[model samples]
Every structure is written in structure tokens, then in C-alpha cells.
Target: MFDSLQDKMESAFKNLKGEGKLTEINVAQSIKEIRRALVAADVNYKIAKEFTDKIKDEALGSKNILKSVKPGELMVKIVMDEMTTLMGGQATGINVKGNPGVVLVAGLQGSGKTTFSGKLALFLKEKKSMKPLLVACDVYRPAAIDQLTVLAEQIGAAVYKEPENKNPVSIAQNAIAYAKGHSHDVVIVDTAGRLAIDEVMMTEIRNIKSGINPTETLFVVDSMTGQDAVNTALAFNDVIDYDGVVLTKLDGDTRGGAALSVKYTVGKPIKFASTGEKLNTLDVFHPERMAQRILGMGDIVSFVEKAQDQFDEEEAKRLEKKIKRNKFDYNDFLQQVNQIKKMGDLKSLMGMIPGMGKAIKDIDINDGAFSKVESIIYSMTEDERLKPEILNMSRKRRIAMGCGHNIHEINMFVKQFEQMRKMMTQMSKGKGMERMMQQMQQKR
Candidate 1:
């Protein structure tokens, strides 16, 4: 998640930390370092230069004006502002205005188009209270339809698919009519993807665009692809002129180039970012938060907003009751892990936390980390899962052998689980959890 870019930018600011005042020479040197850092992050050459130039001017202008703020703090503020401007200065949202409003999802192969479609449908259904129909427009691959079906089922959204229809335009049109008949408020069309930008593919998508006239046509591109992603975005924008962009796979080792310059290059805002393959990992793009993240200041506000959107009130109350009664079990622990997984992969989500990114940047955190824990938990009998305290050494060893894990690992996990349950039960019994819930409800 732009780990290298964040490291370089943080290094750039370290040179100015001990300085007494923001002089012309010191400001120039710091801005130079910032520009180099952006270049290292694969940002476009001219945009990086222009961005730092603005920061330089701002830094110098603020030096003699503000007396209360320290030089380092002022410099950080200047850089944060310039970075925000570089990445569109404001957040944009997807438009679902029309009755049975249509949102066309277009992206390159493996860009997570189908997965994002499912996530968006669930977001609309749960967060916005809109009945959404998932339309399978990828007629090229039969498995694409199946993929959407699985995701749609998991999200509890209705799906429309025509396995025999070779034309995507027809499928989408029929799906829209079906949604109207079924009283669905929104229709999300998951279109086909290409290996690369091509004329035939562009023409076909353009024809579909002309037929559907979608309320929001999103150009989904892989942020990991860097400059090529921007180029593909420009190509697609030229043909269909999409409403917004979707940067997918930001949970991967992205260089931060595409996310940095896509809005500037295509002259369209990036409305959503698909951080992972999970159906609930989609987030509305916010330039200020992203700039803060790039500068190594965590975006806790955006993180909380994402959780709030996905968190169900009734489920939270049920979990609260369970924790208060000290009835938390391995099943509840597994459910919590699944919720975190849906927010994004564990590594990426942890990286978004304030200082954890710097601490764990070198570590390889992947899906395999969850696999071991899941296997160990699955090997436990239902009785053991319900009452973890009853697991003696013999029982623990047997469970360890059943899961093919070491006894030490199983013991460590159980210890952590027990500690977590204790902390949660304490919180549930006190006002701390109530206070937090009140604050969250107020925000809503």
C-alpha cells in the first residue's frame, strides 16, 4: 500500500525536523527532497515538480507570518496541503440518482471489477438502504458469471445473469428491465475486462455505454500497474468518458503512481478504491485522507467511517450482549477475524493504523497468516470452541495435532484469545464501550 512511497516521503521530512526556522534555503532543500520522493514513488515528472513548487511557495510565505506554529509543523502542513491538491483536493461519490440507476463497472482483467461490483451493491443495500440488482455483463467468460453469483449470494444481493447471451449490451438491458420488474432501486453492471487496452474492447464497451446510459460509469484500473493504469484510464475516458475512476488492488504493493495522478491525467475524480478482493473492502476515495496517509499520518477518520458503514447495529448489540455475559467463544473470535478480513487483507488494514506500518513494513503479511489460525480453530470441537477454558494440556495437544500445528502456537493463540475476551468483557461491563457507541451514533 505505497509502503516505499511513504518511507521515502517520511525520510524527506526528517531533514527539516531540527531546523530553527523555514528559511529560503532550507525550504528549497526540503521541497527538493519531497520532489525526489514523489519521483521515486513513480509520480509523473511534471506533476511532482509543480506540486513541490507550490509547497515551496507556501512554506516560504508562511515562515514570517505564523508565530505560534513551529517550522517543522508548518512545513508538514504545507506539504500536506500541496499533496491534497495534487490528488484532487476533495472526495467524490458515486451517483445513483435515477430510478433503477445504473453503474457500469469496467476495468482490466484481474483488476477486481466483479468483486467491486458486489461490494458496491452491498454498500448500497446495507448503507444506503437501496435494493440493488447485480447484473452479470461479462459474457466472454462463463465463470465470470459464477463469480458474481457467489459474491452476490454472500452479500445477499439479487443477481441477473444470462449465460447464453453473447452480447453484454443485451444482457445489461434485459437485466435493467428485470430489476424494474423486481422493484430493484439500482442496477450494477459488471462488464468484461481485457488483458490490455485494445480498440475492439473499447468499441464494445462504448456500445454498451450508449445502450445503457449509466448514471455512473466507473473505470476500474489496477493501481499496481502504475503508469500503464493511467494510460488505460485515459484510453477508456476518451471512448466512454466515464463518470469516475476506481483504483483497485491498493492492498497490493502499489507504487502509488496511478492513485497519485489518475485524477489529474483523466480529469475525473476517483470515486472509489477497492483495496482487496473482499466484498466489503471498497471505500470512497478522499484526497485529504490519502495525502495524510502518504505523508505517514494515519487516516483514522476514514478507517472509522469504513467500519461504521459496514458495521450492523443489530449485530453489534448482539455481540455486546454476548461479551457482557462473558459468553464470547472461538466462533465469535472467528467472526471478528472475518470482519477484519473483509475490511481488507490483514497486512494492508494494519498498515493504515498510525505507527504499525513503519513497524511491520518488512514483514510479509499475507492470507496464509489467517489460514493457519483458521485451520487450528476449525480442528477444535464445538464444545471446545464454546468453552475454551476447559481445554487442558492433553486437549490442547490433541487439537494441535489435529490441526498439524505446534502445541506452542496453539497455546499462544488461546492465551491471546483469553486475554482479548477478558478485555472486551470488562469494557462491556463499564461505560467505555457505551461512551464509544454513543459517539459513533452521534456521528451517524
Candidate 2:
């Protein structure tokens, strides 16, 4: 995610931790580095200065304090606090409380507005048990409606679109009416985006707002736009006065500017973050977790919550039992891959573990990593998946040709799978080892 910023922040904190006593010169040096790192991360110059200035003050004021805790640890606490404050300090979730609650989606072109809308609808429908109706308000783009429809279908959410009606306001209004009639509890109107802040775009969104009177208006901005995202968010907030901001494209090589400064700049809390194109890749914005992530520490709580959401409990229990019985095989491996996919992209999953993000930062990880294993598993018959030991040299040769892979590659995957199976088996059979492993992965 913000790997560079994380590294720099950790380095800055390192200046304090190893020192026996905090000194004015060393603290000032660390603060300077911290400011530079924030600037490099695309944070607004003014905000970055103010943030570091706060850290410097805190470091100096609390000098020679907390004898048991290192100066660096205390500095980390200060930086974490200031970083969290800059990013809204607290997690403010979307307000979808009204009967037939309304959520208005607004953003620029290619900001993933439509996808976020669908994700939000599905989130409310599946997570909150609310019947959601997705209203397509982007009448200008011919494919916008279809894109929303495809996403809605994938998530099993209902859609309300009018290709014949060019007016988004009327469509949104009528969709709410339809939702009311059908007992739908949530109506999310997905509006159009502009290349920039234009008069026509603002006017159209304002008209839609006036007509539907949404319970929550979300301004979706692409985090990859860097400081430009903060500027655009300001413009949007000035026009529609949105309830919250939704930062999209966080999965990209975003410099962390928008996330770190948008709320402070626009004076609106970021309610959600869209990490990927997948419908289940949305996460409620949390300032503390984000600050921890920016500081190079992993977010295990959010990661486990994501696993809980995407992984089936019954299936996980079954796999755990299989591991305990030493029956974890290619079938279990395939199931685990599916479970990971259900969570989101491969890189995003790796990022959940603290140090894995740094380790895999430059690695070209993709679904291709799973391809050879999947191919080998598919090459095997059902019985082989159940019992992998049956594949001797001759059997492995036949399986290799069937999957169009060399024997070496198949053997490599099989070896990794075997190692993982053994590890899982040992952990499951040991007393309270699985929890410890989970904690270790969470820390990593």
C-alpha cells in the first residue's frame, strides 16, 4: 500500500527507540525526516508541516518521560496519534438508518463510483440484511448502466435503471418510489462522474441531491490522483456538502496523500475505502488501522474481519479438522485458494500480514502464482485430490503432461503444498498452536 511512507516512518521512529535518552537535536532530526517522508508520500505541504510540527512539539514537551518505554516507542505513539488525527482520527461509518435509507454516490470519471455503489448495496443487503435497490443515475455513459447491472447481478442485488429516461434526477426519484413499493430498505443512487469539477457535473449532482434528498451523500475520489484528489474532494464538498468521502483505488500504488489529508483538507470524514474492483473488496475507513498500516505495522483486526466475511465458517472448520487428521491435500489447497480469492486480490491479501507487504512489495504476485497448482489439481482425478500420496514418479509424469507443465514445476508446487500441509497438521494437532500462529501472522 504505502510502502515507501511506511519505511520512512519506521526509519524516523527508529531514531528514537535505540537512543538511551531523547535529545533536542536527535528529535529534531527525526521530525525533519518524518516531514520529508510525508511530503514524499504526496501529502499536502501545509498539512505535512503542521503534522510534523505537532510531533516535534510533543516529542520535546514529553522529553525524558516514560523511562520504561523507549523514546522511539513514545514517538511512535505521538506520530500515530497525529497521523490518525490528520486522517479523521475516528472511523465514521455510513449512516443508512432511515427506513428506505438513501446513499448517493458521486465521483469523477473512472473513479469506481459505479462499482462502489454496487458494493455498498451488496454490503448493506448481505451484511445488514437490508433490501437494497441500486439506481443507475449515469445516463450520459451508455455502458455505465450495464456495468452497474453486471455488478448488481454478481452481488445478487436488485437494480433500478432507466435507459430511456435521460434525466438522472427523475430516475433516482422514481427508483426510491419503486424501492418503497417493493419493501426495499436501502436505495443507493449511483451518479455520473466528470473529468474535473465542471459546472454541468455539479449542477446535475446538485439536482439529483435536491430531488432524492439522500440520507448520505458520498464523494468518491481516486486515491491514486495524489494531491489532486484532495482538491477535487474540496470542490465536491463545496457543491453537494457530502456526508462522507469514499476513497477509491487504494489498491494501486497510491502515495497515501488523499487518505492522509483529504479529511483534514475537505473537512469531511472518509467513510469508506474501495481497495479493489471486486464487490467484496470494500472496507470501512478506519483512521487508526490506516495509520498503523502507514507506519508499516499490519492490520490484523481488519484482516481477520475480512477473512471472516469472505471465508465460510463451516468450510474453515472442516479444513481445520482435515488438517488435524493429516488429510489436508490438493483439494484442501484448492479450497484455501478459493477462500483467499473470495477475500480479494492476491497482493491485497499479502498486504494484510504486516511484513508481508514489504516482502511482496516488488514481487510480481498474481493469480498466475496459483495457476500451476490449480492446473495440477485439476489434472488429478477426484480421488487424487483426496489422497495426494498416490502420485509417484510415473503418475506425476502423466499429471505433468496433462497440465502442460514440466515435472520440476509440478514437483515444486507439490513440495510447497506438502510443507504447508505438514505445518497446518502440526499446528492443528498441537495445543493452542493455531491461535499462536494466527497471532504471529497478524504481527508479521
TM-score of each: 0.89, 0.93
Query: For model 2, how does the per-residue alpha-carbon lDDT over 1-444 read when each residue is reduced to its tens digit?
Result: 888888888888777766886689889989999999999989988999999999988888887677777888888888999999989989997788776899999999988899899889878877799988999999987699999999889989899988999999999989999998999989999999877789999999999999988899999989999899999889888889999999888988888999999988989999998887778878889999999888877788888877766555456667677788898888778877877777777787777787788888899887577787788899998888889888788888989999999999878877887898888788787755568545545554
Deviation of model 1 at 252, angstroms: 2.0
Q: Candidate 2: how many backbone clashes?
A: 4
lDDT per residue as tens, model 1, 87-199: 78899877998878999999888888998899899889877999999999898864999999999999999999888889999999999999889999999999999888888
RMSD (Cα, Å) for all candidates, in order, is 2.8, 2.8
Looking at model 2, report the run of 10 residues with the lowest lDDT sum: 435-444
User: Candidate 1 deviates by what RMSD?
Assistant: 2.8
TM-score, candidate 2, is: 0.93
Please report the candidate that would top TM-score against the real structure.
2
